[model samples]
Target: MDFFNSALGKNITFVRPEYFIITGFVGIPNMKYYYIFLFFVYFVSVLGNGAVMALIFLDHNLRTPKYIAVFNLAFVDLLGNTVLVPKVLDIFLFNHPFISYNDCLTFLFFCYTCLCMQSLNLVALSYDRLIAIIFPLHYQVKVTHRSMLTLIASFWAFVVTVNLIIAGLLTRLSFCKSVVINSYFCDHGQIYRLACNDNTPNLVFGRFLIFLILWLPMVFIFLSYSYIVYTLSKIATFHERVKAFKTCTAHLSLVAIYFIPIVITFTMSANIHPNARIINLSLTSIFPPMLNPIIYVLQTQEIKVSLRKILKTRMQTKVMAKKVIIM
Candidate 1:
């Protein structure tokens, strides 16, 4: 807030949310235990995603369109969680939820960016799988690294433009004296609801975005998988069918893990404690990023092989050092 005070005193004061109190997870009992659990989650998420990215980065064999998308997803997972977890933890532990308006918007921007990035990357991954399965011979030509990168760049531009429009509307809202964001972070809906002026525009647009962001990517994914299933049906051999199913196992698990809680939590939040619900929503947000790499590690033999190679190299290096010491 002080930094904002120093930076934008008179020039930039057009209906700003000065300070907001974050009020999710703070109401929970045993603050210490919650902190510990969150720390564990944060550590695991970083490690798991970082390891996957490292494997993809270092090994040329893993550098395909599929793994490239995986790398991007892992990156956003780490990014999204890092932005919120540490800050939210600070709020939870120290009772310091009062955040500057600028900072809140910053957090919101990154949150939406990460969400869109993950969703789009998943859609890309699904398309890659779809093409590979549906057009085995021409898949290589269709889904090249250069082509996927172009799609990624386009996706980045689109999501940023959309989110910027949302944020632009958010800045236009008028707030009352009591400017407190009642969530783990500055939720877009919560802040909009606090506006003193007519917020129907905000509400309508927000709802539309929810439908757009959630449903459209999922529809594409479903269509791709439906095509894959149709293609699989033409295959006669049982072993071949099993192999094809194995390829989709990781992605299907990740999609289920991500989507189920979103459907359950948002729809059912009204029936439960609002703070509890927001906390649960927060959990859902971070949990997928954490779980994604774990799912890959468990389901993907290539990833396991990479892990084994990494471990073996480290062990051999250690052995060489020990032998030197003995000499």
Candidate 2:
């Protein structure tokens, strides 16, 4: 039993593979490019999400179920991206590659919780649009702020529970053999590969979780949009249809971003080379959060108007201040 023994004072336990190497884009020449790219992603994700959140907070007119979903998704984007992207920068810039087992587990816990929140929040957003499209007259009563807040709370509850379950199961496994994770960050599959004993239970559990976490939500989203299309078809006016289509495009794009990657990445997992997979995984973490605010908030008409108004007011105030100073 060759456990990777470590003596870290009193808080010690029987652990193997004391630490794992995070080889995120290693051997790529001029590593500053990766750092720049990650920084851009993290910065934009935070800025975009934060801007939208502040706008939503200040603009009471935009406080509806749909915008609430946007706000929640933005929060999730800021959260998950912050958790993982900074670590990526640390690895590349600070030359810190070793992730202790406990730290890795903790990171995985928070990271996946955010992901689950994102998936379910998108589902909630789709449902909001569904009600708006299908039952426009009833939308005010059907999707109240209270209802939306409850839904958001329930989403947090469900995601935190599921993530805890997955993390608990993972922590139960013994890793006595290989510990070399061949990719960037603490990927679940890459880490699970290090286990010496049969990992079928973990693998099966992970697959089942995918079905619950992603597949179910994807199906629900598709179903909701399916009904939305049918309802939209009943509308006699072309302008109404166009308006509806525009509203849905943002969410559908988010859906594509969220679901398609999982399918493609998993399908390609078998035959694709490691480096390619590494890039795929890294981008998956980066793209959704980075793009969500652009699609859902900034591109929307109301948010744009609100932003312009706020900026124009600030400019007017500045000019008035200059006149006062001149006097």
Name the top lDDT candidate: 1
lDDT (0-100) at residue 327 of candidate 2? 100
The lDDT for every candidate, in the order shown, is 0.83, 0.82
Give the CA lDDT, 0 to 100, for residue 312 in model 1: 95
TM-score of each: 0.91, 0.91
- Model 2, span 1-327: residue lDDT tens: 233233222344434567778776787677688789889989999999999899898888888888898899999999999998998888768888888988887888888888888899999889898988888899999999899999999999987887777777666566766666777778777777777555676798788878988899988998998898888899899898999878778889898898798789978888997777787878887889999888866457888888888889899999999999999
Give candidate 1 regions above 4 Å deviation.
Answer: 1-15, 324-327
Predicted candidate 1 versus true structure: per-residue lDDT over 241-290, tens digit per residue: 88987899999888888777887887897799886787688788888999
Clashes of each: 0, 0
User: How many residue pairs in model 2 have overlapping backbones?
Assistant: 0
Q: Ten residues in a row with the worst lDDT in model 1?
A: 5-14
Error of 2 at 307 (Å): 0.9
